[model samples]
Target chain A: MKNYSNLNLMNFLTPGPSQLYFTVEDHIKKALKENICAISHRSKAFQQIVVHTISQIRQLMNIPEDYYIVFTASATEIWERIIQNLSIENSYHLVNGSFSKKFYDFSVSLKRKASKYEVALGQGFELADLPIPEQVELLCLTQNETSSGVSMPLSDIYELRKKFPNAIIAVDMVSSAPYPDLDFSQIDTAFFSVQKCFGLPAGLGVWIFNERCVEKSLALEKAGISTGTYHSISSLIKNIKNNETPETPNMLGIYLLGKVCEDMNRRTIQAIRTEISYKAGLMYYALRESKNFEIFVKEEKFRSKTVIVADVLQTPASTLINHLKEHQITVGSGYGAGKDKQIRIANFPTHSKETFELLADLLIKA
Target chain B: MKNYSNLNLMNFLTPGPSQLYFTVEDHIKKALKENICAISHRSKAFQQIVVHTISQIRQLMNIPEDYYIVFTASATEIWERIIQNLSIENSYHLVNGSFSKKFYDFSVSLKRKASKYEVALGQGFELADLPIPEQVELLCLTQNETSSGVSMPLSDIYELRKKFPNAIIAVDMVSSAPYPDLDFSQIDTAFFSVQKCFGLPAGLGVWIFNERCVEKSLALEKAGISTGTYHSISSLIKNIKNNETPETPNMLGIYLLGKVCEDMNRRTIQAIRTEISYKAGLMYYALRESKNFEIFVKEEKFRSKTVIVADVLQTPASTLINHLKEHQITVGSGYGAGKDKQIRIANFPTHSKETFELLADLLIKA
Candidate 1:
């Protein structure tokens, strides 16, 4: 951790698209001025970059050859898309935390005959704990919950697959995909946003779907249930194969994402994940030392290696939050009913050691 | 357009995040190296920058004092949000082109009762001919149809306000807002994506709503209709006011937008608009001179000041398109059914004079 005495004024700790990479920025500018912006999406020129980038993403994630990466908007939009395309009458949703619950709720709202398998918050899904139904066609899980700071083990998913060979498995890896340990081959599909692990910006949603999901999407499209308005998976796949998008894509964001992916490939997700673990550990150690503060999640297995959630045990959460704010150390307040009870410190890979140290020092003072 | 003879291969002409700015790229590099990616949205430091940028957007657009400028994923999301939040059972959509038709179709699919006033494909909305419905709570129009290369007149919108005082006027200025001469005072609300006129990357949506729309959003929230899952206006407003977002905000995109806005303000929109007009004129003249080309939009008033659409009257559109492609000249193929017959050229302020001439020269080669 760097000394708190001299730090840049801009660093704050929220999550997703909350950080910017300078090289990615420069790449965007160079592309713009070079007249790259004037090229048509349908032309061979644009398609190659898009196609190449997808290959890079797949290889980086160690995705199986059978899977294809499809880009969407936020992972939230994917909820509807998933329901529209993949969810048949009976699907099982494994709900462990806030985001997972939201996804389950959406499936219910869509009136899909879905069942929820609820686990304690922060106690992520375990293969043995899953309720395998006779008629279940698909299983949904969140690899990590951004709000609850939970990361489920991949083994849990593989175990489910082992027991239910016919059931299609889908994972929300918005927060988890950025970490190096995420292997896309274990599940039928994994989706995430660039804001979290990718550390670029928001607006674009990224997904990797195995051949099974693609087939499922085609089946849904053929059945007349449209899972897309502008963000259709089938249409996206067709365009992506050609290094293009069906509609006007967020060009700058995608271009920046390409640069981010290139950089990530160079640094490797392993090195980045190591750095993230170190930062989260520093914050964890700092919280553990304080009698007034306690970590929000109870289980070590479920704790997020990226986003750290801590609750103020002695002082009123708001008071401790206010104290930190006075020192210009910004952190996330609790969401929903947990307000004023917990604080979230996001350890994005883009953050420097000095920034983490400064934040740790501020928390100690508070 | 820079002597395609000497240029490298590859081109992209999608509407936004269309290209990167060199200066913006440099700034991104500086931002990344400082390990400054860890900035928090609610921190005073980041909040100040966001607030300032929003203020700048407001000022640049000459938005009314009562309206608020906020950001979202893309204007596409905003389209759904507007209908879900503000449509009070009935809306009158002005369908002059493809985009307007798409918006109307979306509203209809949502099971909302909406009426449409159609203009010819190349024509703009004429206030004198429009029907003012007393039951219609919102009047929707697209200032520029990127697909058809048509731009509606701002003066017509102002005139409609005088006649339809009870109805709120909402304009999709996604293509026109970034250019000059957008009179915000006459309209109640306007939405734009950062990728187009703003000259930033895609992923960020900017919408300025009047007091009436805000009240409508509040009313919907009170009524308990899920305003929208991710595209809710109420959530966006709350987040923006907090210097936060309903979901993880796209920080990198917004940061780049802020930089782009600064550069825009330096030159001013009027100056940029002038350059755009100059380029448009050159292209229009070139199309007029071409042996096989004819302007698709018949009337001068109906033509988009920003984009030009030309129909290949003699040679097949693809033949000419492929010929241009061989030279590494990238331009748009028409959307939907017009794909085989027309080409669209966009002349943003950033496109240099030499670029326009080169494109013209290439067309003249046939």
Candidate 2:
């Protein structure tokens, strides 16, 4: 533990828990002796904290009056639970990139009648490209593709809503929420990991569900599908309604989440988005001059302003990344198909010009 | 944060992160700077650390050289992953209590053909009462039933191993791993939450798998029943072989876990087990004299030496528990079936005689 503190070199560039706030870390240490361990998950005090935090999140998201937000392990865990609970008959998943494709595959793995309307990589799934659903039970989309560093055109979701009036639409905003233009009213269920834009640790995933989705779950329960006993939507609903979780949660992470949320509310989500845009703006401009680099996802308008995906030109990305690593700088490799051809640079809100410039200098030197 | 250190009344009695060592908490705080935020899961340094930890855990558990260990979110998450990854054809789950029942239900939910041999609450599982499978793919057992405070007789497992040589056996030792008799050779996979006996936070679950289970997973892969791609047994195998996780792990938790392992290594497992026994003995004797208190689980041999479950004889357990709360003493409630009927007194190694005396005095007055 002591040696790690003295290392002085090493950078964490992979997305999420972008960087821990010293204030929050200190707060958790102080909380260690504060009776957090002995309290039952079902206790009124702990329940009140859960309720308050959920309510605070709802306010932050500007969720619809009828919507409810619940917490889970991570966005990935919710991916599985969504299939286990909400897929009653069939699920129509829209796949534009790697992450959404994984979701579609997960649904199929669960033996659900799942179909996908996929667009080519570096392309957005236009409303025209989505197939007409025959009795669609759930509509799934990744609002922001963390893997591809792209955000779906918001208008496409609105267009889909017009076609499937009764379908329960679920969106993954793991990298989008706590950013701008994330309207919660249009979707039935939206999930995000608090670690990304929220700037907390990797443990908690926040899920916001509309009344329609809740009704569908109740209907499924009445019909005896049972969904599941643990990760079921109904069980989550009950826990949220009572302001508690069914099991003991990752309390420290949740506590830090509350702190992160409080900090965000003070700073404003728009400010964070503006900061992300600034970082991306600086990075996009710097990478353009380097003949060895090119952005992967085609349209700049649809590309994620928070995460920049760049393709390597002459040199292998590994070489450039290793050059940066020599200076104790860190960045991520492109996921899946983008692999060696691309590199991902996350411009988290807390990341500063000094850090971004440090990377730019290294890339230029390389 | 400073106020918590100054305050004399704060007592963290919750299940986990029960109370972090000051040094452990400080290391995490300092790591949040620029170092950890940039480290990659694929880095050789991180991989080596992971390998070292796994090797240490193997040595501590007395695991055979061929067996391996994998890490997960929590022991609860492993319950689902275990049945999903290992159960190929049929499984026999011995459900003696809540945690065991939940594991059985999860198997059934996964569409796995599962059989349950259950015993009444507070009574530990006996091999004689369970149906010995003619051909079992895997056997599931929870060594320590946290909710009911009963540990399935270890002798039963030894006897079953002799009678059923081919069946792979899995055990949930979340609340029992800190103490003795963790012979990994007899069991196929033994999992535990780091927060329990490990005395850390609740993010990591340590799973030790036998060579047979690994072979079976590979066979299942060849037969096309690959556990979901992201959660494949092969990914875990690759990770364990290299001493790293396939995904981004809780690095801070891993550091704390290493510290815990070092602390445990300072004293032999027998010495640590003795301390646990000493603390449990203190709590048991304190409760023995109270006319209104009786052990929740009947047999002393089957009792969890780490967690004492005591039922209120003539009064509501919650009422007495609430009385103790005023004095800043914290204790857990009976989980699942024992809810409202029993008080759980955790005999964590760090908890001393002074802590026990405070609780005993409060209970005597109440």
Candidate 3:
């Protein structure tokens, strides 16, 4: 009964699956014209596309040579795979929002000993005096909490990596990837869906994992523990070396992702990061000046640059959402139970600086 | 090296990821223009798209009301899931080709007691001779083997179902669905990738199963057997009931699949089926009349009405493949060891009648 028409025409500013990368439409059109969608995963032409894409992502992300970049259906799949492949006895999670909590739930569901240090919504996690369990095989951390607009700073992540040297540190960069200049030496694994910072269509998830993660997966798999098939680390690794996937993957999605990544590489990752930070600054500044609205995350350092949330006072969050929607800009209502109180806006690379200024003006009026 | 160029522009007549349904480009354009690619999976619009697509598929494929249709990343994933969710100790497979054999391999990979009734490549299974083990919890059958173009006729599938009444039956209709008049009451589970007969892009797998399969999955999950999360049969059933997926699915793929299904429904599934059978007839006739090529499948009943494979003699299969490539008609080289000896041409709904005739002429000349 939410009275909203013209939803299909609205430009999405919601956290994930927001506005597509500016070059996406053109890439898709070119793909169709080139019959890229019709190519077989086993075909030489497809293998070349795979090579080109992986190379583009590696260069753009500055990934180490030993790290393997793999494709999965979604970041959610990566959560399940990480647990299945890397952990056997126990796993730990830094749960600040729903997404991080789900990784913990996955371990529990898979009959593993799962532990977590959970924070309330709109709160941040502190590593000091945190109860991280002993012999915890995998530690899951969310770099950016899309639901609450809270992020764990890279320095804290690096510190945790130092503390848990024995544990495989996996980062969920679902909403913030290229924005985070992650040190592969500190992180064992990381994953992100294309809909987020890459601004491609949903369906593809890029899993960046180092040799350490692969070795653990292989060891577990060798011991007759089921790490699943077709997408097992060994299987994915075996196929990806030949420029193939263990299964017939999302050919069009992969092509679009590569093209978008190529476009980003040409623009230089530094330029993209600069735009994202600039846009995020504008959003936070507007929120600070709005007398009726308060920033959701209490600490300035914990506020996410990619997913920005604000708590509204006099006007309902839905009212602000609708006000923006009228201008063909659709912001997110609060996630989970706080839906009516907070508005979330994504400051993705696809979101231009000029558009952010206009959105800021509209938010101030609201 | 295969010495092929301009591959991206060639029209694919190979099996999966073949020519897209004629309306695909239009649907994609509309999707991009309407901001369909940007919508959140949680949005009501997306759920409606799911509802419409599922309904369209149900109507077009004649899926029964009691059966549930779910999405997976690929048919290979479905093969893994069918083994994971349904089977506990033992599973049976009727393997006639590489795809079918892989399903059996999955059961073995997952630490199950797996047995199979395997036939040679380009061969079909006979029920009378199958050494089906007792206490088998699940049965895997590939309705249409894309690798070898060998089809298990519906009558045989029904007979197998009758023989294995206690076991859950799973059919891999990866390359030939909508064209097959499947009797849902006779089978427990069936799956296909949209890239195949539905003529969408790669990445989306449509899995259809009955209440019996659901019961097994739920019982296994309840007993802490780890049927999987997010896409477990129970989770899929739960989310799909609300017209949603357990994870952020391929929204673009699902949207385009729905539009393609809608188009097929408008043309009528009956007409589509009639056209497929007719075109398949033309392909077989062309193979029979060709002096240098022979139909790979020995038995007439075993021949596929979708993927058509031919054994090239005198001239190498690669030569015929290149000849077709010259005419911009891309056919699949044989699967596995037969790659240089056989050629495969797909007969899908997306392939036009006139194009088939032209292909037939060119193939004859080759």
Candidate 4:
């Protein structure tokens, strides 16, 4: 591996905690000047922050009015909450990679009857033949699998919603939020951590759930099942109604997230998504033309636009990763089983067009 | 209310989320420059950060060799984790104020047989007369009740330990960590949020547990009981053994915390505690000499040195708070029922001696 003694100038291309937005430093400085981190969570000023944040997120994501936005520590916490609050006995998960598999394991850890339809790694799901159990109260779908660089298309998500109409459809948009243009009216819930697409620090998770999920949580509570404690859906709703959180939250993260969402809104989500497609195309083209690399996902439509995974053909994955690292550019090694044979590159909004062009130049030369 | 548009130059005195340490800005800037927030959680670099942070905390707090440090979203989450992992059916809580009461409620929410010994808002526990149920597996104690500005003395903690030898003693030091100077060997577990005395931004919690707590958690898991999902004690321990987290944690917070703890180590925890005492003395003297104010905790021995609460004698609490706000200094209102009747002032390490002297001068004339 290359020594990173001068890594202060490096740019990140890792998946999830990808890159910090150019605006984050200034917003964080403003947060310090305003004493945003010092004020009480119960203060009127904080309530305004929370209200404005939720409103900006709703506007940016085009979230429905019936949907409620709640905060968690991370998206992983949301997985456990879904199992605890939304399902009493059984839940079905469509797992294609590490993160989705972890969600499935969370359900099983909670002693719930968790059944999964898992495909081979680096493969996307075809919802047409998925079996829906009548006893499964919740169906989990990972819209974008970060580990394998495979994503279930938005149309597939809508199809799953139509087929499992009675089940609460929870989408893991941990790495794909604010870009997927997901319809909130169709899915019961979706969650994303801010570190990914939002280009903020890693601390806060946004959980958007409709009234049906809340009703399920309430029903579970009424039946004397333990949904959760402070972060239970009922507790979160009660606090959010008053524009408050049950505990002292990551105030700085929330402030920066709101500011970033406002920035994204000003830039227009459609424009951001368009740029993402262009950058992803640049990355995929470079990989296809490179003599030493190939795209991991077999189907073109299933390949992720955000996190791009590539298989090393003529050299170890580390050689290419270290070559980039030597230039103060950082991307992720393939996750889990693909650690040595694959490399995952992030195509986030923060990775500007110029940076992708530079990376493409490097890839093509190799 | 005073318009705080010009408040950027002021200091904060609110209990917790109260004040940012002077060093935080430069540390955060360095974090950004180093791309600390964007690194993969599974990387060797991130693992080194976690190991260094835990080491610094252990050094600063004089943590025993057998103790293990873990991270959470906030200290409030630790309350739920304690009930889930350590206790099977019964737990005992000593509730004096809102935060402690909330912990008791968390146990009840999980459908555990939770029993609490309640006291008036500002009163401390008298362990001598408290009865311990033989069936209780966990004993919940709050060292510093942030809501009421009352604290259980360190002596009381030791006394309770001797009396309930078989029970796991869980202490909530949310607002008084690294200041309480508790002997960890006597307690099974203790927790605090970094936004408090650590003087960092909110988003991360520090949970310190001994080997016995781990054993209990594993025992519960082995007995076919659901301890928790991802953040269960067993899961946390499993990950910590690898110097990693069960999920993607607040990476920036962990980095900043390690930096702050190193700074604290340089200043020495003893010196920090000494200054906290001096500032508390200054604030208490101001309240005692003033004709309109008095300390809220009736017992001097039980008064918290970190968070000082004062009853407004001839004016509403907001009057004094607004007076300070006009000068661009922020203080906390009395919590819950005391909201309008009292003022809570923080005597954290970040609040300098000169600021306290200035506020003292103003209070003496009021």
Q: Considering only chain A, what is the TM-score of each predicted structure?
A: 0.90, 0.92, 0.97, 0.98
Task: Quote the B-chain TM-score, candidate 3.
Answer: 0.97
lDDT to native, each model: 0.71, 0.71, 0.88, 0.89
A335-357, model 2: which lDDT tens digit per residue?
77667778888777666667888
Q: If you assessed candidate 4 against the hidden native complex, which CAPRI class would it receive?
A: medium
Put the candidates in lDDT order, highest first. Answer: 4, 3, 2, 1
lDDT of each residue in B97-157, candidate 4, tens digit only: 9999999999999888999999998898776668778657999999999988999999889
The TM-score-based order of candidates, best leading, equals 4, 3, 2, 1
Provide i-RMS per model in Å.
Answer: 6.0, 4.6, 3.3, 2.7
**Model 3: per-residue lDDT, tens digit, B50-79?**
888989999998999989988989988998
lDDT of 4 by residue, A1-366 (tens): 123235668889889788798899898888877778877788888888898899999999999988999899999999999999999889999989999999999999999999999999889887666777865799999999999999989898888777778999999999988889898898999999999989989889999999999999999988989888989999999999999998889988888889999999999999999999999999999999888888999999899999999998866789889998876678889898798999999888788999899899898997
Candidates 1 and 3 compared by DockQ, better number:
3
Candidate 3 vs 4: which has more lDDT? 4
Which candidate has the highest DockQ of all?
A: 4
TM-score of chain B of 2: 0.91
- lDDT string for model 2 (B1-366, tens) is 232232236444434434443245554555565255335556565665676677667667677888777777777777777776798867888877788888888787666888988888788865666776769888888888877778766787888788788888898888778675866677788888776667666667777787787788888767767364445677778766766665556666675676667666766677777777877776777788777788878888888887678887755677876777677666777776666878887766556567777887776656
TM-scores, all candidates, are: 0.78, 0.88, 0.98, 0.98
Clashing pairs in 4: none
User: What range of 10 consecutive residues in model 1 chain B has the weakest lDDT sum?
Assistant: B1-10
- What RMSD value applies to candidate 4? 1.7
When candidate 4 is compared with the true two-chain complex, its DockQ is 0.63
